[model samples]
Target: MTEDTLRSVNPATGELLAEWPIDDEASVTATVERARVVASFWRELGFDGRKQALLRWASYLVRNTDELTELIHKENGKPAEDAYLELMLVLEHIDWAAKNAKRALAPKRVSPGPFMANHEAVVEHPPLGVVGVIGPWNYPIYTPTGSVAYALAAGNTVVFKPSEYTTSIGVWYARSFALANPQLPGGILTAVTGFGATGAALVTSGVDKIAFTGSTPTGKRIMAAAAETLTPVLLECGGKDAAIVAHDADVSAAADAIAWAAMANSGQTCVGTERVYVDETVYDRFLAELKSKLDNLKPGSGADASYGPMTMPKQIDLVREHIADALERGGRALVGGLESVGDRFIGPVVLIDTPEDSRAVTEETFGPTLTVRKVKSVDEAVELTNASEFGLASTVFSKSHGMEIGRRLRVGATSINAPLSFGAISALPFGGTGASGIGRIHGEEGLREFTRTHSFARQRFAIPGMALLSFGRKASTVAVIRRVIGLKHGRHS
Candidate 1:
């Protein structure tokens, strides 16, 4: 039997905000089948037609920003202003997907190669039938929309399953899109509500691809389940991203950027700065500046606070555990420490002298916490930063060698002199390496992730004397081909 209702509650006050009927096995299968049928009509619309429909949906989001912002605040406990910013960024991504999809996915001619010079070749990208998206509650609109918008732009239908805690927000996304484009088929963009079992159903429900965002362990489970059907998956797992400060970095600017990145959204971000490496030349100055900034920051349920309560209650315990491990291993808190982790609202924390082997230094704390370590040089900083298996995104602040140093990071995205700036630009792809997950979302790479490509070639004419592809060629033709290959490639070796 299907579960009755999935309740969405406010993490801060434990208030039940809304309830949605959980989609069971039968419902989930039906939804996928419906999407498969609707995908034909969606693909027939072509890029320009789909672009218009997506633009209308973007307009709907803009018009209802206030309502959506409130829902996000209630569901995820982020500050209203932060929630609004997230909505605006999603709008930007939608616009990019709409305007660039046709150009990016359009068929293009390619040279046929030397042996088949008389042939014409072309490559085309086609939409995968239906895409399944499993979203996270943190930045619900922005994160899921990254997959949804690109999938729609690429002429594929979408079946979105948002985090259980933000089920209503997911419903609002689908409802708003439908209202904006009433002519669109119902299953072109659908939302299913449920827990982990529902997501498992989607993975095996015959979808072409799945885009998931959450913890590394959960990502592993999803991948294993998808492996049953050989279904391709794009896993945007979380990160223990690092921030490196060079000796030449602007002490104040670096401190401010790190502080904001660490504390924003209560540090529920996948690419947020969790560990920091500062060169010894400016280590003390950076810490002093960072501590000063953290002192003014406060976490609370009110909108006036710098950040709100933790969106996931269990994350608080993880934060406390990591901090305890660091402290027990000779780490000292320069700012708020173990006591700062409240029941829901976790205050800002800045730790120094944390051992390299400490949990705080190695794990994805996923909280408003920062572990700073002093390094002798930028190379040491890079080596230390790359120590973790989680390589999602990283940041570096340097005056003359910012880009040079950032290139050393083994992350999917890196920001120079900025914190998590890679996530703002719709043109830059976002994801991670190693345990941070695989595949990419956002930008041109994102549009391609939801589609497959096919290449075709046709012979315009045949050379009268050339029978190289057949056995009819003379022995001299083989000699001539050998000489040609020798002349072309012999010098390279």
Candidate 2:
């Protein structure tokens, strides 16, 4: 790989910000090999060594929070405040993984069956050699670090291929790892820069495991590619998450959550609530409150702005098309229309009277657009919410039955009287089911996800029955054996 070959363009301004090298196949392979060797040494360091090293990395992130946030903002086109939030979340994961990896991944004893009582059984978690991570452009640091930090804590070396759109932040992350521990090999925490081809190379580069975060289609492609190498994968794909506002819900609080969930980061979040199901009894009132809140949101790339431009310019057209399709199909835009989209940032959009089957409700717009639908009961709300092929995160607001409704919704995690709150807690497992993808990455599962379980059985001594089996066997011996076995294991009391 050569330096200063690829340029990083700011999506908000279309300006050339920075340039980086394009890592080729040879370099990627070499990096993977280096990771394999380093992983061996890292595994030997055990939980305490890895934990201390990760804590040092967390400290670095905390000490240089502003600089890291700035790089994230410049590379991903998010507001500085949101970038800071991302860094904070990443640090939380780093802290949690360091503290919990030992208990979560350590070997544990298991009971052997009576037939094998002379043997001792234990299961140990071993590192999966090298792990390849293909991260998304949105929430660059927080999203990938959920996997990267956990993988490291589990004793696996990582080769992270951040989205080409946010390669600078990726470089910054890898540089931080090097600065924290120079003894660590290059592949222990490596960064590879390129387009989709580079990501594809990482998935197929004979890695022990691959953790990917992106669209469903891209996830399917990555899974297919990994299948060729029989490598396990953890995919965090797209989600058309829904927010339900019951009649008993707190109107103001629900409105605030919906506004933040839909418009934050210009609604480029995978788990952002795109569709809203409001009880018909309070539909008008909820819509009014939501509209009032949306009206105050200002979209721009300035330091003080509430939201930033869409990180990927091409998504703007898709947002437009979805809105246009909904309008053509008898849907009405209550707050914003075609004029809401600008050269870079898109103003907040709230739509109502949209058909259930409209593209606006069914597909992932990935923009600052919220589609509100009226339902008669919570059953109807859950039906509409689960109608989509994507099932990631969801939110339900009901003072009386928030937990009930949340449990019924088909999503990985649900927030009651809140939005994206479940993800904020590093103790919970985060990932979706169905088309949203499989597997999890957080909490104890997160650490174990990057490791392979190894079972160890040690034979203590041979049983008398087994030793006498080849010596001699008689009818009386068989009767005695049966009686002993029956007395030991077959009694009802």
Candidate 3:
């Protein structure tokens, strides 16, 4: 394939799936400009029209779920079942956005401040014209749809750039969306394929906003490029999400949750559990149960496999490097170790007593490997978890105080008594706080993320005593405003 085209290879068999043309900077810019025209029409459709269109798209997705799942399997080397689950998640978001967008984005009356009682004020959310999405290979359908569904529901057109490792699946989505509405080809939703250059082109392509899901370093690069155009970018980046097991927690349940979180999708998820901190009182029990569960899980690109292969081949090396470093630093493997990381599938590698400073604990392994640490108390566990620079989402496995502990953790979303379950709840917002992400998706917050707030005020009648709003009214205007402010807010002081 030439530089203008990209080749999609199946990670499980190293077989080429297809060759697709890549969009250059000029083409990317043109795509965004075209989207702007369609965006105007889409926005004019109002919430009701957009909702109908999105529901049609969701229906198309549901009708073709089998084909889409197979495409994801071929392109990303994930199991067909997992791909189906991802599709289901995407459909849930689409349905939620369609049903909730009108209520979330509709203009609502708000009481004017105490000083302007005679004025009627309202707030309206207007579409952001066009949005550009840069999706990741792992969970490509679910991750990008988090942005695409919401943006469309809020009346914004989107230009999606799926990861080069999974370009065929991205093309499938674009085609299906077009099929949903034959009148709009590149207008409402479009897909661009390629590597990093194509994504960079999208970032600086004059879109109203860019929603990116990838590594923290790549997110920084996207932000920097978007800066050149003063474009707003919402980034869902890397994470070293931790699962904390309190002393009084259910050891078996926590172990099961941790095992699934760390090993699902071969541990390629951004919010997947990478670290586990258990109370020293029950750490041994938890570790034993976790190893027992993880040992039974298998990784392969088959129907019988518990999980699948690494979508990106290069991630295998990083997983190996982290395992080696952990072992070198006096860590013991409870399950699979360096030898488990193969060319395509990374078997479960469970490390125990790993040093805090080790690469396995510090860096995002992004593999089916997890490092378990023992802490004296839940307080210590929280401290250790918060010490990491990446705070995307966390899980607390305490029965009595799971919610309390979750609230104390500094992250975008927290799961109580479960592992990353917050992602499945369509009403909850999903995004990271620090390096995890910049903006949220999946709920009302997600719908608002693609739109801008416009405040409206119309004076029904004049307030005789409210003179501060008028220019050059009177010297008493300042006195009246100060007295009112003191009456309303000064009591607390």
Candidate 4:
């Protein structure tokens, strides 16, 4: 591909908005090497300096909100309003990281065991040198910043590779930060652009750690590539997340949350609600309310529309195939039929009474499509929810037993009466187990994720005969040690 000729085509109007050169392998390697050099300086600056720099970056984001949001909309094919929301959430994460980095990464005095009482023990989180981040296109700012901001605040220089589909937005993010903090080292936050090969190169590069957010297959590939260098990695992969509605749940409220979770950002969200399990008692009522809420949703490539075109064109066929499989397998379209899908935008698609084994129920149809199934009870709902390979995120909508059901579902974070809103809290650890990927970002866990713990101990006083070379009464010393342990921790006979 011609690097300089690369352009970001607006999915809305099929117009070329901007173009930039694709950073080649040599450029990527040089950037990472420079980051490693700068990381030494960034790490030595201590938490205060790093936190202030992050805060300044957050302020810059807020000040340039309009310009950034418009760029995001043009590049990602999301509504300008939704793009703004993504940017705002990213800023929130930056603010939180700056305020909490010291406490989260500071050393603490740990208790020494009785045998080592004369020594003082301390454990501290230290930076892991340069970090490589391979970000996704959806929620371009929020998703990547979850790793990038936290990594930076933890004192690790970052080399970020934004999704090839949204490279312009990524460039815009890095450029703005550089403009805001010109005093920082140039490589403190560097941006590279390319396809899978570029991302693969990043993973195998000499970075101490790699953080990736993408599909399950790509996540596996990243893990394999990281293994070549035995480098540590954090993978935030795909999810077939579900929302469970209990008998006592408020049907109208559940409907609203479900619609937003399944359709937001054109249903391109990693933690978006794709499957919904409703108690048979309120199944009919819940379906009615959900359909009514989705009735007025308009999906198109325009400013006034609720959602815009799919950022990735290939996803449209997948959406169509999933809907077709569900209908072919006796699934009923409660609100939107197959005709709802457009050339670029997919209108709201709500599948009701979908069979548990159908593609719509089992696979992740990352579109404005939701599969609703009626279950006998909350136990059944939980069972069906946990059956999927993905356990990224889920929701429980119940007035009396919201927390109860939320705990039963196997996922990273479960929201009560909400839809994937747990991600909004920077104090909460995000990421999933199982096929959803490993490790976490955000909160105190995020700060530690980018660091390695080092333990130090220093003897305050020297005791005679403690060293093996010292000449002493060894039999008497052993007897005294045994007696002391027996008097202190021996079980009563």
Ranking by TM-score: 1, 4, 3, 2
Model 1: residues with Cα > 4 Å off, grouped in runs: 1-3, 471-473
lDDT of 1 by residue, 140-212 (tens): 9999988999999999999999998789889999888899999877889999989988998899999999999
All candidates in order of lDDT, best leading: 1, 3, 4, 2
lDDT of 2 by residue, 303-335 (tens): 778888888888999999999989999989999
Off by over 4 Å in 3: 183-186, 463-467, 475-493
For residue 309, give model 1's deviation from the true position in Å.
0.7
Q: What is the model-wide C-alpha lDDT for candidate 2?
A: 0.88
Candidate maximizing lDDT = 1
lDDT of 1 at 90: 92
Report lDDT per candidate: 0.91, 0.88, 0.90, 0.89
Error of 1 at 307 (Å): 0.8
Error of 1 at 235 (Å): 0.7
- Residue-level lDDT for 131 in candidate 3: 95
